[model samples]
Target: MKSICGDLLLQRLGPEGLGAFGKPLNRGLYECIRGAILDGSLPRATRLPPQRDLAAELGLSRNTVMYAYEQLLAEGYLRARTGSGTFVADTAPESYLNATAAAITDAGPRAMPGLSPRGQQLLANASASPTQWGAFMPGVPDLRRFPHRRYAQISARLWRQPPPEWLSYGHGGGLPALREAVAAHLRVARSVRCDAEQVLITEGIHQAIDLVVRLLGSTGDQAWVEEPSYWGIRGVLQVSDIGMVPMPVDDEGLTLPEADAGRLSGRTEPAPRFIFVTPSHQYPLGAVMSLKRRRALLEFARQHGSWIVEDDYDSEFRFSGQPIPSLQGMEADAPVIYIGTFSKTLYPGLRMGYLVLPRELAGAFQTAHAELYRAGHLMTQATVAEFMQAGDYAAHIRRMRPLYARRRAVLAALIERYLGPGALNAQGSNAGLHLVLRLPDDADDVAITAAARAKGIMVRPLSRYYLGTPAQRGLLLGYACVPEEDIGPAFDVLLGCLGECGHAAHVARIG
Candidate 1:
């Protein structure tokens, strides 16, 4: 089997001979092996030739062959037989194909029994999902310009003189050092008031949302989400099979008048058990939930015995005045879950975030954490903890705050210049990386975004984020990925698309 597999691999390496570099073979051999695996030339249970044998055949190191096999195994496309030998996992994910075929039948989704009906719907929709940003998309930080070299330096420092205890599995909550650093950072950055014990680190704000949703309301219970809210969070709620009640948001944010909550209008016919809001800077529309509204929401949540989930995704860089206090900090009672993410503040690839649970709920969350994912990577957590405790994270944020603020200003100025007055109406430009680009009423942003993509420009349609009513029809263009010099040209091209689509009449007058 190993010899046959080698012959098959050799056939794929027809044109470019195997060349060695680093631990993995050079581009030629890597592609050859990858192509064979993709094309099914190496069948299931075909144990690969021992590393030494193949290395000799291809003039490569045994380590190179081993590295390729390790990558394949990590990606779930192959399996190792321990000391016995390595072989392809069962030739295909036969179960996946059968499940997919079943999903298309009236039998109603057989492949992914793990997903509920709502989860199935979200998955189906995600299949055709487009780019993450639309024109003038707000709330996304410019991650392309992040200091990768600085982070590499920090990682190197931790590796040089590693702490023996940092290698163990991180605590269910988080590394105590990171938690302490997060608490101090929050105090200075967002005015959040809490001790380290209050913080429960999770994967991202989405996971924090899920943990809170599952902990607070079970499947089929009413959960109030802001209208024109984060669709990702809504999808998470849907997958959990929870009943979602869309609450109307005003300039102040989600307004459930004490009278409004109890009386139950058409929108709130079914009472909500909890309210999910992005008060610091409301998503999409960019409206800052007012201080008055924040107090009102807390009062209402307390009165109705409902929990509040505050997703403070990008509240650190408020350009104008002081940042608003988190609902968790302002709560008079014990029912708010405050979630934060380092994805935007640092880099999304870090994959670390935390949920600040109310004191009453921390014990239950700790119990739930044990069953999910076992424990987080202790080394990364410890390194990050050092980054924060040593004042590097705060210094990084200070440097980024002005850099991002300038970008926001440049984008705003460009919007004012090229699009003209009223061509775009923006909210939450006072903070956050992206802003809303409200388009003309009749414009079909979905079609417009498709047109932009053909020109190598990308934007997100606002309709993608909402469910109840077709929220505003406009694009969400992220400014974070576009460079400072490219902003003008990008918008010009974007504006040209709008004009080509016949919406230029509404836009041309604005500039």
Candidate 2:
């Protein structure tokens, strides 16, 4: 009998058993043993010492040890058999064993170094605790609310009056009608000037980034990324083994580290092949690049013979002020590769988005895309083309913009009233479906997130987005999916948790 067995027994028991304890001592013992079992520190089938022997080791009553074991027997996580010693349950989750085995295999001596670095990064970023948020987080539109009735009507009409080649694959660029509509949408909405031929439809912005990376940047080429930018882009760059030069971002979007006449000055190093930015609305920080900075960036690109990857992820949801002109529209030397997606504005499930690349890179990207998919699916592309042509897509964006803006406002006001300054200083509040809340320095974002989940509030910590230093701890609160009424109470819960975590006093200094 050992003192450790008492600890191990408690972990095998569930919360029900732990809560049933009438005394604090029982609760402590119950929790200790329960944790050990769940963590597998106490292997299955380890025989428990006799009750009297265990009681002697832990200085607990024999009755206490017996009672704990009996409670564990009632739970399916463990099992007992008469005349046989207690053993770990044979019925442990199959997936658990499979996962453990896979880990061992992956780490075998023969495994190559640097293998799965991307997978490792993904694991590090994945949330360890339960998320209070639902599946349709912010930045995700309600596709169910899409006007299916109207789209159905248009789709049916297109089917009836089919072009003889309607059944055939569209041009590698995209369906002409869809591209034309996108061109028109860009001109009127985003102030982008481009013909239908310039738009190359792909799956979404992620694929668009992939295409640009493949076509323009070679392996080991350097790419400048905005700090606290889109995580997917960071992941893509890592997987590609591309060198990353992190340019600091301010409230006015990405500020080149150096000043240059045409090239961004300060980089004594060779300029990156391209710099990736979310100019219309900066990603996590939500800073819109001013006209001056935009001009500087383009001039720098031109001087260095670099390209710019502009991810206009949420340009459609401009809440105040007119939409900004795209850098690609102002390109004098085909120096910008602008990527836009229907995923956020339309529906993510549509899997339709396009890249307006500089003419220099278009032919090569088209070749890469062709080899990757042979050709894009004809049916879905055709359906999407019809959706865009009938003006249904434009109408949907027009209808949802104000609705999301209202939600954004509600979320901002709630943050002000309930969380005060301590919880998060909401940035990027002027537009976009979500806002970033700067957390206190002492706060453990991971811990705060877990505590919030315990109270049924979902939020994302800003730390998850960064690859370098933990820029600032905060939550990425998405309002698009959350109902307007819940905004206030959600903050109330969040604020209450912040107070309990000893962070309330820091609230005043947060923003």
Candidate 3:
């Protein structure tokens, strides 16, 4: 032990760091030894030098070294065996030093691994907002208004005496009561044709879409997606290696001729295995699929053996006429999977969503869901079931609809008043939590959105949702999460940004 210390000590403790003799010698020696132990220069379990020898080497009084050694011993940094000299303690500090050294060694230069081609594609198409809740950040509900105390009371009651089965892994298809509640609610509210047995609960729309893409389509299979659709769906499909055919959408909803032409023109690509649509209220653009388009879509899918995924997200907040009936319920056995979530209705943290599947496909989906991801969260499901069964869910929606409508009205009124009708055209504002503000053809939506973000206003660029060249430039301004009082101020900030961009463009044209 002494030999080890002798070999390393001189180089480890430089002359400059060690104080001159008789000038705070004890404190200087203590600091140097402590630093050595902390830096791993004096390894764990190594015996420190004898006080007499250390004092002799440094030409210091023996008392100075003795005081330093005593301080270290008292601090538990060094331990003395009855017959053996002092050694470094095997304590948390020593272990931390060793761990830090190992980390540094492992960080040595090496080739960093790369993501798979599919993963790279997903990354390239990622569109998640950096800030989830704020002014003009789309798809986020105002969680502040949620009935937290009521939900907490229910949660506490359920946890006080949880069912033994619920304490373990839950059924692949969610809690039976929740399924029944969701089925009953949908049947009456959205006209979705489904029974409790046909509803499969998922984490959210993302997981539901993932399950469909994996189960129904093979890798590289074509899928018809509404151009300027939800970016998240695009990422999910891309990661699954499904080829996406971007179909244009007008006020009526997804156009059928473009998809039909692609199939009939002998494009050499495989027929689309699925068509994903937001029929009730299209995301970002907010167009409700017309009844005519709905019938045509169903017929086309039936003929081509393609499935349709109807993402009816946020359809409950419609301010106009009665809610549109789901496309799945429009035709018998329409090969449609209807998805709805509580993220918009309640809160996103609930992470509870359901799929209304065709009777024939229910069993397969349930089995696949179990095998792929063992579903849990039975307690939360049970609580939500109670919320729905007790009529709380319906009452809550009725209460929130008007509040969201008022906020939407304020946003629309401000947009028209500030930007004028010709400066920006608002599309699909009759329903949904967000509206698309179309800018001039030459405007740079991305640059304008970035400028808004710098001013603490959150807005998504419309062009980011498109796969091919964007036909129009715009911003997706969400009004649901923004408070009524803050809406005008937030829009004021956004207006300044738009003015700056417009000024820049005008100057560039003159140049």
Candidate 4:
């Protein structure tokens, strides 16, 4: 019996070598003997040779063999009677574990469980583009031109002597220094009325709005959003089980919802509890909110006790005229939650943004944000603060402003020359990084978008932005990320696609 066990041990530790298991000699020896015992090569009540004898036979040091024996004994794989040598344990996990593995192997493949209702709804109305980078992918910026060298230097410097708080999860919105830097910048640049205490750091606008919705929004409540606004927040609201009322937008931003006396225009719906607006440069349309409309919206929110959520997403690179002031700062004690993100100004991967809450809500939001999101990215916040302090952030934006303006000009001119003068959206006030190319209302924009995608150009159908009946057919052409020279070639491909789709500018003009 001892010979049988020894033979099996040698077989396991033999041709493959003792180091075959990628473990130390002792651990390897222990594993080999334990496996032999579990497989019943050494039966219960079978006495074995002394440790020294096994060591001699195996060509291992006495202590290595001793260590292997000790481990087996400790793990109940082997036992020693006071007067007898070590033997295999009376029972082992082999009977149960081996039976389980065999049963599972015989059971064959399995189908995954079904998703929850919430999970199903999330997949239903997807907004993100599969092809994120290319000639005309909308909302993506030029990552190639980011100031990586300066950011790296700034990051390295801060990491060398970082304050302890910068290395850990933060409380009180974010690092104080970062909040102060953001506050100072927003006040001068966007004319937002906020102090350092009111600014709360976030991962991005997504997380910022998630916090807002979770904190303020109730399930089954209604919110008003621009008909063709960014799909992100609407998705957030939907997942929260909040209903969306798509308000129409024109040349002066979101048109006030029509009056049916006290109810929503043309419907019996109640007034919205929340209003989401992109005032500076309306997302797809690029219509700046006129002073009259902005004032009217504020008064409505004030009168109805509704919260106004202002998403100042990409106003930093405004290329024409003086900058539009933020809707939040225009009124004292305004019921506004101001959201801004660095996704547009800096690279999207940075995932840094801030919110300027109404003064009363600041402290509660800081606590709630820390509790809900477990706020992190202290190192990123610190680095951005250092960059701002050194004026690199401002300088970077200044450099990028003109670069984007030049790209926009080039793309706009190309559209004019190739697609004709009426190709552009007249309401798209020459400011943002993209241009909305108008199309015939009768044309099938979804079909055109698919055709353009097949031709290797990435433009979103303007109709896809609308939650209600699409008012127009068009394409969103993003030039910021596209190289200046490549814009022409890409537009040529797109123009050909327009012809193939039979929705060219001439058709729209004739109709």
Highest lDDT: give the candidate number.
4
TM-score of each: 0.76, 0.72, 0.79, 0.79
lDDT, candidates in the order shown = 0.72, 0.72, 0.82, 0.85
Q: Cα deviation in Å at residue 170, candidate 3?
A: 1.8
Off by over 4 Å in 1: 1-116, 127-139, 161-165, 257-268, 332-334, 508-511
lDDT digits (tens) for residues 482-509 of candidate 2: 6667777677787788788887557567
Q: Which ten residues in a row have the lowest lDDT in candidate 4?
A: 96-105
lDDT of 1 at 295: 74
Put down candidate 4 lDDT per residue, 1-511, tens digits, no spaces.
Answer: 3465667678777687688889999999887777666556677777777888887777788899899989888877778888888887887655545652123124767999998888788788787888888889888889898889999998998789878876777899999999999999999998899999999999999899889888888998889999897888878888888899998998899988654445556767777889999999998899999999999999888767789999999988789799999999998889999999988888788899999998898999999999988888898988899899889989988988898899999988887776677778888886777899888778888888899999899999899789889988888988899988898889899889988877664643622
When superposed on Cα atoms, how far off is each prediction in RMSD?
11.1, 14.7, 9.8, 10.8
- Per-candidate clash tally: 20, 14, 0, 0
Off by over 4 Å in 3: 1-107, 258-268, 423-426, 503-511
* Candidate 1 residue lDDT tens string, 330-351: 6444477778999888877688
Q: What is the lDDT for 409 in model 4?
A: 92
| CA deviation > 4 Å runs, candidate 2 | 1-136, 155-171, 259-268, 421-429, 454-456
The TM-score of predicted model 2 comes to 0.72
True lDDT of residue 234, candidate 3: 88
